[model samples]
Target: MRVALWLAAEVGEGGRFVKQQLREAMPGVEQIDRRMRDLRPAGWAIMTYRDRAGLAPGELLLEKIGLPVWEKEHRSAGLRVITASTRRKVFERDGNRCIRCGILAGEIYPDETEVSARLTVGHVEAHKYGAPSGEENLVTECSRCNETAKHLAAPRFDERQVWDEITELPRKDKQAVLAWMAAGKREPSRVERVMSHVWQLPGVQREEIFRKLGRSLS
Candidate 1:
């Protein structure tokens, strides 16, 4: 809590600070760096140079301070102690793909080619009060989607912009989109469900299956 107290008292919101400053302030305290990151889920907004322009490397901008974790009552806020078994079950259930965007591990995003997706387990209802850490409450998500879901940091399209595109779709396609919205999830089609399993096959097994399917088609 010393790190939190230091940030709260010393580095108020919209303040700029460096890593060295934090290190020097908390001498001999192992992993004080990680403590700063732990505050993020609790609503802290510490941005690196990559997150914002005009900042030098190794400098961070404290945009917002969330959930006074230094306080006694809020110490455990946003902390989810998920078990290993639960994590494995959720990943397996989701076919090791991000349930939010259906992106698989190490796959490049359609628009962003800079970094590939990495899988992580994320809560379905993030920041929900008294949320359980069970498999039912969790889903597989890419690191990007997990971060987006947490803060909704990405740019959002206006309802009119989205409605314009939706209106242009065929009636059946529009109905399909509405069904997905109402259900809060997009159910994979038969081909998609089969392809999801196929994508997980080993290289040799995948090649053999491909040859068999090709021969059957001919």
Candidate 2:
């Protein structure tokens, strides 16, 4: 509600704002960023530096405001009516990483280091009719990818290019890739599991663990 009021009154469409500004407006409200993201599916166009140039890190560009969620009529525009337990289970099963891009929560994307990825639950086959909101049907996805996928606006992948790369792999590797495709989810290796857990740890703990591992390797 505060987010809606602030955007509608203070920062109108095409206005530039930052995380700090939002935090200031809604003092003591943690997860204001998440509140902002909740408005996305309702037609809000809040672009970050990663999505739009000229915006600095922590800055947000409000390209367009979709639904007036603050209004009584349109209050539930982008809200997903899922249970809290379901949300937790889905996140845990996916190891709190985006299955689409393999991006872990709060980790910066390789190409867009300025923007950190936030994990969200998304349907594996979004367009499928009567898709159940179960562990089998849901997967972890970053907010960016989830929104793009929901809108069917993801960039086109060249099948031939992808196929060529796949075909060039060794026979065992090709089979492994095929198995993952068939299952529709890639099982993480032991090292990947460790890395995912470490990525979620505090900075100090992560660094200490890395040093310990380095010593063990030596």
Candidate 3:
């Protein structure tokens, strides 16, 4: 029982079940085959190494997925087509850093295969906007970050509607509303408020924004 619980903690969920088991039973633990079966619900997955003894030095295992990635498709080619390019030129141009996040591929990832063309090339502008094909519009993104941006990028909402909704709220709420409307809330509250005030005061609502994003900010 102790061995099973320890195995679960080390290679399985390692959650409340394992903690409870340890508290209830302690001292000498032996092997770990008995507790493997019937431990998890159908999709409550756990990952493990093939064998610890065979592992190369400094090669460790990932024992849990934590969140399973349901890959709908390898999106790079589709995105390239959408952008009217056989290859995303901007990814080649930027040297594999997400244009928005400034994360370079070699900086964080371990896979040499992922360092170049396999790195996700994200669109700085909307794909619907002529599906920008030029290198000026593409940004290198990791698949994870690209997934997040794609999930967040939906149909546009009216900024006027946002102002009307939050005009009466506290300054903080007003900031939240503006931040929600911006391109991923990259700026601080104070910066947004000042920008809004500047735009509103001058009656030049978003010309500056267009100018700002017109070229590579990188």
Instruction: Select the stronger candidate by lDDT from 1 and 2.
Output: 1
After superposing candidate 2, which stretches have Cα over 4 Å from the reference? 5-15, 19-31, 41-45, 50-53, 68-73, 79-88, 106-116, 124-138, 152-157, 190-218
Candidate 1 lDDT over 36-147, as tens digits, reads: 7667557777877655558888889887788887777778763545656877898888877887777777887776754577777777777563477678888888767776
Which residues of candidate 1, in runs, are more than 4 Å off? 16-21, 31-37, 47-61, 83-89, 105-122, 141-155
Steric clash count of candidate 2: 0
Worst 10 residues of 2 by lDDT: 126-135
Per-candidate local distance difference test: 0.76, 0.76, 0.43
Clashing pairs in 1: none
Model 3: per-residue Cα lDDT over 1-218, one tens digit each: 33333544554543323323443465453322223322211112222222123444433333322212122342222223323252346655554455454455546443233233225555666433235555666666654455446543233347787567678799997876566557552333476456545655544546666566676574
Task: Kindly report which residue pairs in candidate 2 clash with one another.
Answer: none
Full-model lDDT, candidate 2: 0.76
Candidate structures ordered by lDDT, highest first: 1, 2, 3
Q: After superposition, how far is residue 213 of candidate 2 from its true place, in Å?
A: 12
The candidate that achieves the highest lDDT relative to the unseen native structure: 1
Per-residue lDDT of candidate 2, residues 52-144 (tens digit)? 668888888887778787877777665633456777888888887787766788998886656788777777767243346566777788877
